[model samples]
Target chain A: MSFSRRIIIPLGFVLLIGYYGQAQSSYQTGLLPALNVNTKLNRGWSINFKFESRQQLQRGIFGEEHDQDYEYVLSDLALVAGKKIGFDQSLAGGYLMRFRGQDMIHRLIQQFTIVRRYSSFRLAHRIAADQTMSAGASMTLRLRYRLSTEWPLKGQSVDPREFYIKANHEYLNVLQGEDYDLEIRFVPLLGYKFTDSNKTELGVDYRLDSFLQDHPRQRFWLRLIWYRVF
Target chain B: MKYIFPLFILVLGTFQPLSAQLKFEREYRLKSREVPPAALEFMQALPFTKKIRWYREEGYQRTSIEAKTKHQSKRYSIEFDTSGQIEDVEVIIKWKNISAETRQLISKQLGQNHQRFRVRKVQIQYTGTPQALREFIAGTSDESRVTIRYELIVKAKTDGQFQRFEYLFSEAGEFIKRALIIDQNSDHLEF
Candidate 1:
């Protein structure tokens, strides 16, 4: 397929989904933006620092009284350390701090990742587990798996000044005391490589949760991400 | 605010050094008409009926055109310069294809250099005149006029640090030279 057509098809699909979302009472729309910095260390080790924030753009049911006012959501700061165990696999551990209005939450994370390279694209698999803690609340634990693929739009690989497409599908199983639920997420992104150490991506992150309950919830977020390496 | 963080990161990224020593390599697919006529002519003369894919590679201060295909269960890669002059032909082969003595020597050398090592790929490379290579590929010529070398991709641990390298060896399994294969950062995929 032509590069422009490839981009346009998915974009159109996302727009269609957005249009459909307006009629659903359980839908919420927001913006998600994040910045990440990665640094390499000695002996096949690396570190990453990330900051992310969320904001609500619109909410409520279609053809009814809806709240369209902007609202600030929450912020997250994370630090991770990674070790390359093999040419294609790595192990990592991290910590995250979340600030939500007057509440503060902490999370501990561990993950394993494997990446495979093909002639014209790359595929990645990740399995992770995390535990979240907050004052006066039961501990929550989540287990997740994600599969993602990336391919250059203009060449065999994504190089400086080139464009690429990345898509991810993930499933999460969550547990909090007597409660258990599942969430699924899909993200499709358009990325631009500024240089060897820098890149930016804009995309839509769609999540479906609460399906195990009586009222299922859906979220659509416009996501912007920036990555820098040192 | 959301705007402040992204702006700060963009400014920081703009200041990062573009080191001259960093290697830049890229490959692009080419249409049949986009390739040099001479290269296409040479390809047309081959007896193989398999589909051939053409590519243009830019790296190491030079650009080269490559044709890749599979024949009789073996993978073949033929490279040519920009002016359509043939450079080398490489065929992926098994480690057992090498003589037992040569394999022993190669293994000994690798064992001596690294605490742990694994061979990922092995390719036998041929370099000679176009006529000689054509005859060899056709099974009508001997190795008298054609030079043979072995190329291997290896991942090894040296001094407690692991790295990947591309190694070249002579026909007798004597070590020639090795180059480090720098991997692109994959933070986005991992995190």
Candidate 2:
């Protein structure tokens, strides 16, 4: 089969499944847009600033009344500092402030990452721990591990004016008060590199959560991300 | 809230013109059919028949085709011109594979060049006539007709900053030239 067919067929199948699954499961669809800016410092240190916003377009429970009205959800602003620990490994810590309606939540994050480079693709593994605190709520602690891979659609490496594919699979273990749950997420993105330090990606961010509950919830977000490095 | 959209657009617009000054370097995989017939034929003449992958590299004012494979547990990379003529063959080897004298000379050069250095990869490169190269690999001929060189990927601390370089040395360990290896942006992955 041709390369385009290989990619297009699976993507179409997933979208079809998502469309059909709406009838059998509770689903929420939204738009997630994010911007990340990175700056390098001396002595192997770097800083990153990120802003992300979520806007809901549809929400409903299966077999019930569905709401189609657009709603603004939440936005997050984060700042992170990282230090290179090895040739392909890094350690980072960050703080994120989330704005949802009149409430503001704070999150602290620490993570370790390793990036492996192959001839055709690059794979990244990340392990993270985070604590989220909100007004009038107990703190929520979560542990997460994610594996992501990126490959050039045309060549061995992604270069300026090139397109690439990036996919991420992540598992989250969440604990809040006396309750615990697991959430799984998968993100598949098509990216375009404008320069060595600039790129954009568009993709689907799918999440399945509330695993320990009687009813599970699914979210499908059309995600757009822009990354800039200096 | 209404002004945010326009502000974001303005910010993006300001960066668009800066992209023209950036550099471009890329290496991508190629199918067998995309490779030149001469290059494919050269591979066919080799005695080792393991899985071979082809790649096309563009950057630095040059374009070249490379074939990579593993034979007898050693990784081999053969580079060819765009027209499919053989340029050189490189086989991954250990530092100990170099002769004692050559190793000493190489160490001396590296010590003088950097405050501290570590070799990440070492490859033995061979260049010769196509026929001679094939025979040399097949063990049918000696090294008389082939020119041998050592290629090393090294990470060294120089002037308080660490950088990665690709170094080329003669078979006898005389330093020839070196080029800095540019690293790709990993902001997306790291953050």
> DockQ of each model against the real complex?
0.48, 0.36
Model 2 agreement with the true structure over B115-179: per-residue lDDT tens digits? 88888889999999999898988889999999999999887877665667788999999998877
Cα lDDT tens digits for candidate 2, A1-100? 4445544655565455445555566778999999999998986789999999999999988778886758999999999999877667789999999999
Compute the lDDT of residue B50 as modeled in candidate 2: 90
Best-matching candidate per TM-score = 1
- For model 1, the stretches where C-alpha displacement exceeds 4 angstroms are A1-25, A61-69, B1-24, B142-145
Candidate 2 — what's its lDDT? 0.86
What TM-score would every model get versus the actual structure? 0.85, 0.81
- Candidate 2 predicts chain B with a TM-score of 0.85
Candidate 1 clash pair list: none
Looking at model 2 chain A, report the run of 10 residues with the lowest lDDT sum. Answer: A1-10
What is the lDDT, from 0 to 100, of the residue A181 in candidate 2? 94
User: Against the hidden true structure, what lDDT does model 1 obtain?
Assistant: 0.85
Worst 10 residues of 1 chain A by lDDT: A16-25
Error of 2 at A81 (Å): 1.6
